[model samples]
Target chain A: MASKLLVDIHTHVYLPRYASLLRSRTSVPFIRSSTSRDGKLDERLLILDHEPSGGRPVGPQYWDRDEKLQFMDKHGIDVSVVSTANPWLDFLPASQASTLAKELNEDLEQYCSDSPILPNAPIKRLYGFGLLPLVPEITTKSLLDTVEQISKLPHLRGLIIGTQGVGKGLDDEALDPVWTAIEAAGLVVFIHPHYGVDNKAWGDKDNGHVLPLALGFPFETTIATTRLILSGVLDRFPSLRLLLAHSGGALPQLSSRLASCIDHDPVVASRLKHDARYYLGKLYLDAVAYGPEELGFASDVIARSGRYQTGASVTGPAVRSLGSQRMLFGTDHPFFPPLNSTEKWKSVVENLDAIDAVQGWTQTDRDGVRGGNAVALFNLVG
Target chain B: MASKLLVDIHTHVYLPRYASLLRSRTSVPFIRSSTSRDGKLDERLLILDHEPSGGRPVGPQYWDRDEKLQFMDKHGIDVSVVSTANPWLDFLPASQASTLAKELNEDLEQYCSDSPILPNAPIKRLYGFGLLPLVPEITTKSLLDTVEQISKLPHLRGLIIGTQGVGKGLDDEALDPVWTAIEAAGLVVFIHPHYGVDNKAWGDKDNGHVLPLALGFPFETTIATTRLILSGVLDRFPSLRLLLAHSGGALPQLSSRLASCIDHDPVVASRLKHDARYYLGKLYLDAVAYGPEELGFASDVIARSGRYQTGASVTGPAVRSLGSQRMLFGTDHPFFPPLNSTEKWKSVVENLDAIDAVQGWTQTDRDGVRGGNAVALFNLVG
Candidate 1:
């Protein structure tokens, strides 16, 4: 019998077309080459506008499909669902962003479709999540056209979005049409964080990128998603499938407090059809939280959300293991790579170990999170 | 055996002197009498500057000791560690804040010391956490003097401080002396949140205060406490006891992510002596999370910190119940009260129910969190 399948749903890639587009720019989010102290030329990818030391070194690992496959092979991953990395099409004009987003989506679709098929499984090794031109000047018609375009692509199963929606936040009512279109298309919406919270909250000490990457990024996702929930968008679009990065970015932990706050606010109490915890059960979460206890805890929150389902039984055995069914394994690869070239990536190893070590997670539950859930959620089988 | 004890460590109160002081002011953080729709006079408390509808109503429950005792009795709370509510002297001049801090400390002391002794216990029904003058202009000497004074007070067990410390955030090096003094005095520091993050993130929707109170408040606490952790304050003052409100305000959930970020940053990798998760074990958390899974998850995070201790065993049963030892019960009273005048507080009942429903918790574990943890932490058994 074949070993249990291992799927990575949170991996990222930068298509060559997109990289060349970034290289052509002269401002932030651009790529430039400089000489290293060892006398070798090095390419740097700078995404943040205010980054001083250029950005971290960039190479084939970012844009090469072969490098991703090789990395997956070394880590024993059977399948990967790739998406474009951050700051995607956020800075371009309507004309430029609209054109580039279409090209990138096609490039991503082709990139995944042409990948080698697995010998032991009846599926291709690669799948992709498309991008949207959510710029300030884009027309609603253009946005819907892109959604229509992605929905027809064979290998593209979802769309990756940042917190900023059409230059406002995700909660802005202006994005309602986009949500409706995406939901109707039956495509998953992968909500990620690119712009973190303001830097003033980090205080004076220069702690490198720890504050922004670790805390700010997740908190930004939390605020944006919570705003969307409070805006009654979930009530309006109950079938909208959202997969939150970093285990919903503290949302599961804060849902009960949120429910209590809503119950106390007369203006907000009657706004939703169900409690806040009910929404948590409805959403999918990537198991990227780096600890065993956290993974178990997030699954518990997701599973308990079953009790909040409409007409569902609130007692006993019914809600058990419901969370693991919704959680999918994620590597967040091409980011948080190890400094040493020969060493295994600690980021991937930590997540894998967490799944293995999580208490009360039976073999069936672990296998579900590791691959089976993604297969069911993304319809991976041909 | 006697029924398990119930102690509230996260409860709040407003001293009569402080109320009078606010009643005299005309700006935000002040209380003023206004006519209600029914023509009865109502005292409205305006804490946030931009609150349009005046603010929530204030009443005798805020300042009357008898009202507090009655509420405690109604909730079956045998002990309460009350602290002054938010915006505490934050708007006052340094001289005025210092004087009021001193006066308020004494009033709080008298309030707790004079409460009726519990019939089954060897302690009074009240204990308190005093306020600190943590405004923009407070002098260091006066701050230390208040710490010194609170240490000498019989009923005061800790100092309640806002996120801001001496104008800068909690990570400011300027407050190192205050940390030293408080640590030396063996006083617990109860860090709370008043100022949420900047408002622009909320967008154009009028979701009432749900966004700010539910997401903003806890996120603010998470950021402030994280800044403190990244600053290595816990490393400097290893024995300084901290009791974080809102179950460490997302700290336990995000600890692993923070540690991974620290490891990946070249500048931050070598800064701390231990991983970020270790500090979580060193602190105390109030059980105000409001959900069973969240409570269980936080305890697991806290308990696992035992593995990171200097010489403790990494495996075995040593850490099984360690987290319960550090988590204390709390009610956050006088806030989030029931809108219906005659009903019990949903806020209190939800938390109590959460404690009762948490999975894997033994009767002993529940008893510890309900009151034994507070008893041991505060030395309540004189």
Candidate 2:
């Protein structure tokens, strides 16, 4: 039997082409180089408005392949499925976004395919989730063409998207065809949050980016995914292979409330084919939540989604076998790197430790979350 | 041992005077009499903008004490701790809100104090949480005075408030005196949601009130509480005794992420005396979440918060004993009433059943959530 493979399905990368595109822009999403405290040069990626100190400091860890591989090796990560970071083409107009998306997709493919083979593993060390030009100006044909492009790329296993779909959000009817196309292509749709909820929700506190990054991002994903489910996208296309970042945000925690709301609402009660919790079982979640109890809770919600699918009572076994398999391990590298560069990233350690620590999980459950889930879901081969 | 008691800590009511006050207003929050489909006169409570057909249907269930008592008898609920529903004194001017708050406190005290004795339980079947004039124009003196009035009321054990504190959000420094007063008075502060996050987050979909009630209300609570924590309010007043509605919204699920974000942010990294998860254990969450899995998950989050209290590793003990004790059963009655009035309220049953069905909860855990916790928390006695 193959030894346990530690795959990271939620790591990220910014291809050189995409970085150059941002460097040329003068907007909030632009990358501006700045000097570190030690007199070394680093780039600041300003993605949101009113970002403190220009934006987050970006360095070789973001765009350098060797840095990613080294980070992987240092952390005992056997394989990484990387994707482009946020503000993904949302700032561009139609034609320019369409052109850049194609180029970036190719660059990502080349970046992954060019990676060296792992000494301990038979497969290449890197795989990628390509980007889509989901900007409003892009034509549906162009969008479908990009979907086709991503599907054909040998090393690209999925496509990463923000909450906004063609500028109207994931619930918009306009994106139904895109969902249909993605479903048909059999590529995993990685739903990540870029534009968090309105900043007004955070109030006037200068508590840095804690509220936005922690609450806003997750809340945004929860809202977007709930909207998508309420829109009957899941009901219409049951086979869509989608992956949610931040462990489905708060969806797993809020699924039962959402289902109750749907049941009580006269307008939406009869619209869904199954209980709202059922959809949770059907989707993939990155095990990026930092606590064992939460990870266990999320898995329970996912596992129980199966019962909801059958309209069965959810009072039986605490967890179904298939639910933990839907959760994949992720490091979210380059974003939450430790302040002390020599220390293991606390963010990564917390999630990995959570997988190990969650009660009721067998070694199989832990091993599955660590890598087997991603390998199976992404169809990764040696 | 005494018979297991079922206490509902999250039920709501609007006093006769408050109902009449709404009847006198012409704004969105004003109550209007309208004919139902069955041609019977019913009051429509419109609290938000663009509410469908004014707003939700509010009948005798909202303001009639006898109706509440009868409903409790039918559901086997031995005691209820009711608070004034949303938009509580938020729509009034400073002097008007202040005057009304005092009057409402007196009314709430009278309402609970006048309740009939329970046949099965030794205590009176009803208790109350008083209202505060949280409007922006209200003076700090008036706020403190209201807190004083509530503390002196025999039946009013806590004070219910919306996310807005003296106009600014809960994090506003202006609320420090109010928190200090509530803490000094030893009154539990029930933090509810009135103004959800900006509706723009819900997108263009018109899927009834699910988005706002299910997602927005909880999201609003999560943000407000997070802001309150980030501002060092908890650090300043550790024993403030906060009871959050809708199971702390998404706070438990997002607590670790919030801690991670705080650690990563240099400005707010050292702001709090404890980890974010510790704050959750310090809070009392209502078991208003609609499913057993969610209830269990929330309990786990609460229980494991102990480890984070001492900065201990959260890898051990899936659940701590004190955590489940912090949760109390809540019906959120008067709202989410059964559409088919002949049948039992599904909302109430879901919550009740959640307590019964949640895994790993001993009979003690179940009984505590059902009523024992509330009885102890509210200091109820025969």
Candidate 3:
């Protein structure tokens, strides 16, 4: 509120060390020299099961800190709490994962601590949410050690994780200590989605990223979050702060239906003290949903979640005021880059415009979402 | 809205003929004898892959015409546009499917033409949305013939279809003729969800029906609708009118994101003439989303979708005046039955209450969603 600061917490990066690791592997999540459609050879990053277009062209923007800074400057983003993007060392061998994750975390920490683009300003332009090595057979001690290390990093604010946890899922009881460690450290857990539902399950795949990124990603987030709720993680680790990508991946709208189903199912009903909607109140979301109507709905759902128990009104005071803080600004940069270089990135412009598009939202609400929220939530000092 | 008639468009019924077919089948979508927890034997309807509790218990409420009438009376619903419940003769053999569909359509027509529960009422108390066989290897002639037959049926206003079309999904190009036939007939295509996402995709199913119904059903709807959009079905069959169950199955909220993703992707963007959000203006949604915030958001998104094209706003008149005729009222009855005998079904109460709970929604908007929209959209006559 004091000054304008646009922070993009949803931005991503792959450190030089991780890029090297990818370059060495031929499997998925690997980078290799491939001839472009126009016959130019470029290093393309193949991190997923994209069919038609093998993958995207990867260059400095993915790993170069200077490029990230340039992108921020271009988009008017003052600070960024970047994370090691998805497929992040999750596939490393069990023996190698822990050590690699340590290296990656350190590498990201180094990236964040680099000379600021605006050293004259009192802001850290590149803080980060570190990554954990969720390998099979990973010990709770190892996980907690990583959490401890991430929290101690001078510029790290939280830990970023995929829907998977310790090879099982976030619902795995084995992840209790990991949740406890992160919660105790008072760091946010950024939950992003990768490995959407089995590609074959969709029947056909001619639509390209439309199926995976559009439907698969959000559905994955929805299922993972629902599983976490059903397994009582929210109840057990009440302090564990989860920041879901894509505006809780359809959770805001589906929360009531989820709660209604739970109350209807005798088995699920006996498990939860509160309805599924109640847990939404405790979760944080990014304003990456790309529409003001969706964002406003997500905000109201969070406020109305504990409707029966909280007795809170969901007018301007609750959803807007509270949401302005909980729903921080984010642009999933380096992913949806503009097709035309001359124009501003649609992803960034749309997200920024979306913050203003929210109906009935005041300037204060806009300020909170634009940067004031990330300032307080991630403790970004200026 | 003229005399305030309360119509329920999302209601369902399992006709005697369909029940007879299920009773004969050993596979899913069957009605069979099962022992209750208290040790009494009862006929249970197993329409889905629900674990722990095999499937919901069913009896007279599921079949008996009088019970449906009584339930309608209890709920104060004036006219009910019933459809054959999900898995509706989908499993019938190709040879039998067409014949059985004809019988079922006739059966439904007879059911609707029966004497009104209230003789003094001018409108038909019961109307029906017919079912298409959509049998495998079926010729286009067969599909159009069925559409023509349904169109002739006096009380049959629309057709209910699951996400799967001819085993390939609604995107299957072979179903083009059927869509054209239905469009030409001016019959609404009620796109409902069944066979949710593959069951194994959810991992261990300790959550009972929570994952499948809450997440699976809607996600299925989302994917199917997205496929339709991506394949340019909306552009090809521009006159095709669709009534999406579960509030367009999260489509309204995700439409902008879908649009953004489409705009970002080369393959998807190349195929579509309109942005993905524009499809919302062309689709009808049910009020089954279960919260005022969700409904308001759905309404807003649909209006905003046409914002660039229509240039009309989305506050009161723009949303309700447009959304009123687009979003209809529905009670997914006999499905989410009340857990107790004394209380009204949580499904009904939650949905009705959701309409009132939407912030800034006017009385006209409420009426539009409640019944007026259904009457206008379905051409339900007096």
Q: Rate the local accuracy (lDDT) of all candidates.
A: 0.86, 0.87, 0.82
Q: Estimate, for each residue in B1-382, the C-alpha lDDT of model 3 and write its tens digit.
A: 3337778899998998887887887768788886779998788788886544766788877777888888888888888999999987677777788888889999999999983844545678899999888767766777788999999998999999988788888889888888888989999999998878878667664887888999888988888898998888998998899999999877777777888888888877888777788888889999898877778777777776666443445322225345545788888988988888667777988898888776666787788788878878888764
* CA-RMSD of model 3: 2.4
Please give the lDDT score at residue A363 for candidate 3.
82
Give the alpha carbon lDDT tens digit for every residue of A286-351 in model 2.
999998877888888888876787557655755644578899999899899899999888888989
**Model 1 chain B, poorest ten-residue lDDT window?**
B312-321
TM-score of 2: 0.97
User: For model 3, what is the error of residue B27's alpha carbon versus the real structure, in angstroms, after optimal superposition?
Assistant: 1.7
- Residues A1-382, model 3: lDDT tens digits: 3246888989999888888999899988899887779998699888886544777788888999888888988988889999989888688876688998888889888888874844545778889999888978877788888999998987899988998787778898988888888889999999999888877656674776777888788888888999999999999999888999998888887877888888888888888767777888888999998877777778777766656343544333236555556788899988988988777889888888888878767888788888888888888763
Candidate 1 Cα errors over 4 Å, as ranges: A1-3, A310-313, A316-320, B1-3, B310-313, B316-320
Report the error of model 2 at residue B5, Å. 1.4
The CAPRI classification for model 3 reads as medium
Interface RMSD of each: 1.6, 1.0, 2.0
Candidate with the larger TM-score of 1 and 3: 1
